[model samples]
Target: MTAVEKLLGETARADAQRNVRRLVAAAREAVAEVGVDVTAHEIARRAGVGIGTFYRRLPSREALLQAVVEDTVYEIVELAREALRDPDPWHGFCTFAAEFVQLRAMSCGINEALGTDCALSLDAPLEQLREQIRLLVERCQQSGAMRDDVPWQDVPFVLTSVMTGDRTIGLTAADDQWRRNLRVVLAGLRAQQLHTSE
Candidate 1:
């Protein structure tokens, strides 16, 4: 390629990265204030960029939301993987569950912005994360650490419900409360197996 052509391509790629960063920052702030459903134009305005710039970077609100969701899911998956390295499966399960709940709470607004449509193609990473959680939970159950009665498919749903339910109550008191509640829930899950064995 010509020198001028290569320079133009390089500049275009750099500009695109800058625009995406600006949009992502603005979207995060807006979601914190008004929730994720905020318009892309508003996010563009907040970012001090034109609507054209926003559209050029992200084709649609769904696309933007997908980016946010993917970012959050990646973090959760990393945490889960780290937890899996723990020596005890039971402790790993508890740590994973607690961290998962906290991360979900932080990303609640973005998920809300996606609305019911959130589960569309935008949630593939989260679905994969769930599968990972299911495998981890299964490992705990197989080792007789967790309750066997709890189906693998139900792990994500139960943890999500607990976190989302706490979020709805506007409980931002402390991380201790969340951890305590999780322990209680885990106890119940364990109790189910004890009852079955007896």
Candidate 2:
């Protein structure tokens, strides 16, 4: 191949990479706005790319959703790690839980992608997230900040309860009612008896 041909080939590959990044970013926004059922055309339009380019990069709607899901999960995992580093286990756990639910509520696409069976294999990252959550729960329980009756397995359910999604009856996304619900859940999760220093 001529040097010019090689240079052109490298440039094409670079452009493709950039397009993929743009598509993923745009898909995130589109999913947040339109849920998991967002159309490819809309995502492409948001990305400022042609439909053909979006197809060449993501291949299908599921591919785009998976890309967004992967990005969100990685973000969740990082947040969990940061939470684990906090000095107060109960505060860290509460803050993490609130933030986690809020993040999930922002993207119905993520909930759908996670709950449904897709081609994505995220066992390692998922397991890491689970382990971190377990540690946080255990720490809180040991410190008497959390109720012993509430198992680690129940924590996911507690957090997901606030993710009512667009189906919230008589409540809109702008209501900020989920924050109130989270506060209640956190209060219930805490130990009922007060700890006093004698």
Give me the candidate number with maximum TM-score. 2
lDDT tens readout by residue for model 2, 62-142: 766755666677778788878888999888998899878888777666665555664665566577778888988999999
Instruction: Give the per-residue lDDT digits (tens) of candidate 1, residues 64-98.
Output: 65565556566677788877788888788888888
User: What do the candidate models score in CA lDDT, each in turn?
Assistant: 0.68, 0.75
Question: What's the TM-score of every candidate structure?
Answer: 0.72, 0.80
| Pairs with backbone N, CA or C atoms under 3 Å apart (clashes), candidate 1 | none
The parts of candidate 1 lying over 4 Å away from their true place are 1-16, 110-116, 164-177, 191-198
Query: Against the hidden true structure, what lDDT does model 1 obtain?
Result: 0.68
